[model samples]
Target: MSKALLVIDVQNEYFTGKLPIFNRDASLKNILKAIEYANTNGIKVILIKHIIPSPEAPVFAVHSYGAEIKQEVAEQPHNLIIEKHLPGSFTGTPLEEWLRSNQIDTLTICGYMTHMCCDTTSRQAVHLGFKVEFLSDATGTLDLSNKAGTIDANTLHETILIVQASRFADVLTTEAWCQL
Candidate 1:
């Protein structure tokens, strides 16, 4: 089976502006290692970029910066970039077709917002019949409020890891992922 590394939403917006609690350096290091490993081993690497609508405008307005993938993880020449508008990378995107065309059956995922984009994409990949290995430490998220109440960023991060481990994907640390 062909395997690929899916690097999701490692953008400047998450690192600098509004939601900025991300561990930029460490996540970059981990993703770089994974990228290098994939390059050396001939494993395909797909980079998923989330393009959220601009604030206070139409829900479909795409900001230029929000559409950019962070420089740190954008180094690979062979990497394929998939722009997504929804939380799930596969939603309304060519991700499934790309994976099919490339014959990718296993996906090693690492990127931003553990409880949102990353979580949604990982679960969607699983549902689409791909084996998913989620790099836990390489994904980060911010706090969110809902009817259940507010959840802190750190707690939400850990909760997603726990939830994904049980039902969605195999949650592995960067070290463990590298070993695979």
Candidate 2:
């Protein structure tokens, strides 16, 4: 099966901007390892960037430092760089077409905000008929509190991994995924 590692939103926004991730160092380490493994194994790699087009955008403004991909991951060679404005990587983007064209049947997902972009992309990949492998430790999320009360980062991240494993994806740790 053809596989591609979709490195979603591994940008400075999560490191230095308004929203920061939980256990960031660990996640970054695993993701960097994953990228190296993929490159060595000849698997395709696509680095995704989420840009919030507004010039005054609080985060992810296009061409801004916040939206720039993490230098550790950015300096590495990749097959493609997709820019998106939504939670799902495929939404309003050439990601799906590119995947299909490249004959990628499986998507290995990792990067920021486990409960948001990672989950969204997983579900959408399943909906679009592509198999998904979600990296648990390679993904991270921050605590969230809103009208629906509060959810800690660990709870949110685990809950989404549970949801993904239930049907949408094959959820595994970074080590397990890398070994596969």
Candidate 3:
């Protein structure tokens, strides 16, 4: 299968910034490993950065360090770096056109905020008829306590993976995906 790796929102905002991700170190390591593997092979690597358009935004303001890709990921040799405004990478971005131009039918996704950007991208990929391989351990989410009740980070991460596996994507650990 023709494949590409989408590393979504691996930004300082989710790591060392305001919204720190759960298991930040572990997930960062896994994403780095995935990028290395993808680079060593023939797969294209696309890194998506989340940017808040408003200068007065609370976080991820454009030109802020928080909106930039983490140092480790930035040092990697990626094929493309796309800036997105929403949770889904495809929404209001050139991601779809680039994927089609590159003949990418399979997408292996890894990065921060599993319940947000990662999950949205996975579901969008399925809708676009692309096979998705979602790296469970390489994605992360924070604990939440909102109107919809509360859950810990681990539960939220696992639930997103389960939901993706049920229809949207094939959920696998970094090691498992690297094996393939």
Candidate 4:
């Protein structure tokens, strides 16, 4: 299957900004490794950036440092870069057209906030008739607490992985994906 690596939201917002990702160091390492592998091979690499339109936004404000992709990820070789305003990368973005035009039938997902953008993107990819492989260790999230309940980073991350593996995508680690 023709493949493309979707590196989503590896932005400064998850590092120096308000939202700090859990296990970021390890996640970033794996993401970089995946990108390197994708580049070395013929797999297309696409970088996804998240931006909040409002300047007063708490995170990922447009033209803000937080909205910019992290240096390590930004420097990596990629075929294209897409900026998304919502949780799903395909929402209001040209991701689907680009994927189709490139004949990318298999999408390998990596990058930040496993439960949010990663999960949404994976499901969206499946719905659009594309096979999705989610990188377990290469995606991350921080502890979250809402009016409903609280969940630790590990729990939140694992829960998403389980759900993804259930149907939406093939959940696997970066090393395992590299070996494929």
Candidate No. with top lDDT: 4
Candidate 1 residue 123 Cα shift, in angstroms, is 1.3
Clashes of each: 1, 0, 0, 0
- Per-candidate TM-scores read 0.89, 0.98, 0.98, 0.99
Q: Per-residue lDDT for 1-180 in model 3, tens only?
A: 799999999999887787979999999999999999999998999999999998778899989988989998999999999999999999999999999999999999999799999999998999999999999999999998899899999999999999999988999999999999
- TM-score head-to-head 2 vs 4, winner: 4
Clashing pairs for predicted structure model 2, backbone only: none
Model 2's alpha-carbon lDDT is 0.94
Which portions of model 2 show Cα errors greater than 4 Å? none
Q: Let me know the TM-score candidate 1 reaches against the reference structure.
A: 0.89
Between candidates 1 and 2, name the one with more favorable TM-score: 2
Per-residue lDDT for 1-180 in model 4, tens only? 899999999999999988889999999999999999999999999999999899999999999999999999999889999999999999999999999998889999999899999999999999999999999999999999999999999999999999999999999999999999
Tens digit of per-residue lDDT, candidate 1, span 1-180: 888888888877777656674566777788888888888888998888876666553222366564567776786755688888788999999989989998899988888888888889888989999998888778778778889899888798899999999988898987887777
At residue 12, candidate 1 shows an lDDT of 72
lDDT of 1: 0.81
Q: What is the lDDT of residue 21 in candidate 1?
A: 45
What clash pairs does model 3 have? none
